[model samples]
Target: MDARQRLIETTRELLHERGYVGTSPRAVQERAGVGQGSMYHHFAGKADLARTALERTAALERERAEALLGDASVPPADRVVAYLRRERDALRGCPVGRHTQDPDVLADDGLRSPVEQTFAWLRQRIAGLLAQAQQEGSLRAEADPAAVAAAVAAVVQGGYVLARAAASPEPAAAAADGAVAMLEALRTPPRAPHRA
Candidate 1:
């Protein structure tokens, strides 16, 4: 990889493993195997490098979510279930969700923008899927797509938090299973015609 790409990729990994506060320029340089001059040449400083890395992470997340949720061949409700149950590094926590806990990152818009945007996009995407499912009669008529979408997003993040705190992946797996069960409950058959 080129010097700049190396710096960004390394910074992305470091930022995921260590929040903004914990990741340092020296650490990024060491991980990237790039000299101070090369690092500075590509990025003005740590903040610049972090912003680039965070943007890459956000873009990747958006791409994956779009590919899964936007697939035309899969039923909308099935897409939601698939996304919720997809394999994740639960004990390590969400790479994007972890950023919200860092005061340093929250203090700077450059760093926080991607984290905020990613969740916002996810919630909207999930809501869209739910609405489509409802229109298709997969989801019950009374189920509120927006509210359910928020809860679904919460389940994933909460699962990560619980797993990280407990130092086990089981909690995360259970949370995801529970979410799927709840979503399944939302499904209902179309009503039968009334007899005259």
Candidate 2:
């Protein structure tokens, strides 16, 4: 791959493994196998490169989500579960969540806007799906779909953090699966009393 592509991929790998706080420009350069000059030529600095890399990561994630989301022939609950169970290259954390935890990134408007936008976008998309579920009568109507969407986002993100800290996938998967199961349980027959 070209130097720019290499640099972005290296940045993404480091960010996922080390987080924005732990990743260093030197580490990124070394990982990309590019000289300092080549790296600089492609990006203004670590922050710039990180922004680009993060945007790419968010785009990829959204695309993955959209694929499952658009396939309406599939059952709604199945789609929700499949979206959560989708195989991830690194199951440790959400790229958007990673950016949110970075104090430096949060402090810089230029650096953080995309990160904020990423979550806002994902949350909105989740809300839309929840609305669809509600309209389809697969999800209960009492619970605010936005609130439930936020909760779902929390499970996925919190699961990632727990997975990384615990150094295992079990915790994350359980939490993620449990959240979806809880939502699945919300489904009820029209005559059945709905549960939130």
RMSD values for the candidates in order, in angstroms, are 1.9, 4.3
What is the alpha-carbon lDDT for the whole of candidate 1? 0.90
The count of backbone overlaps in candidate 2 is 0
For all candidates, what are the clash counts? 0, 0
> Could you tell me the TM-score of candidate 1?
0.93
Task: Write candidate 2's Cα lDDT for 119-149 as tens digits.
Answer: 7876787778778878887788886778877
Off by over 4 Å in 1: 190-196
TM-score, structure 2 vs. true: 0.83
Q: What tens digits encode model 1's per-residue C-alpha lDDT throughout 24-99?
A: 8989889889999999988889999999999998899788778788888999989989889888999877878888
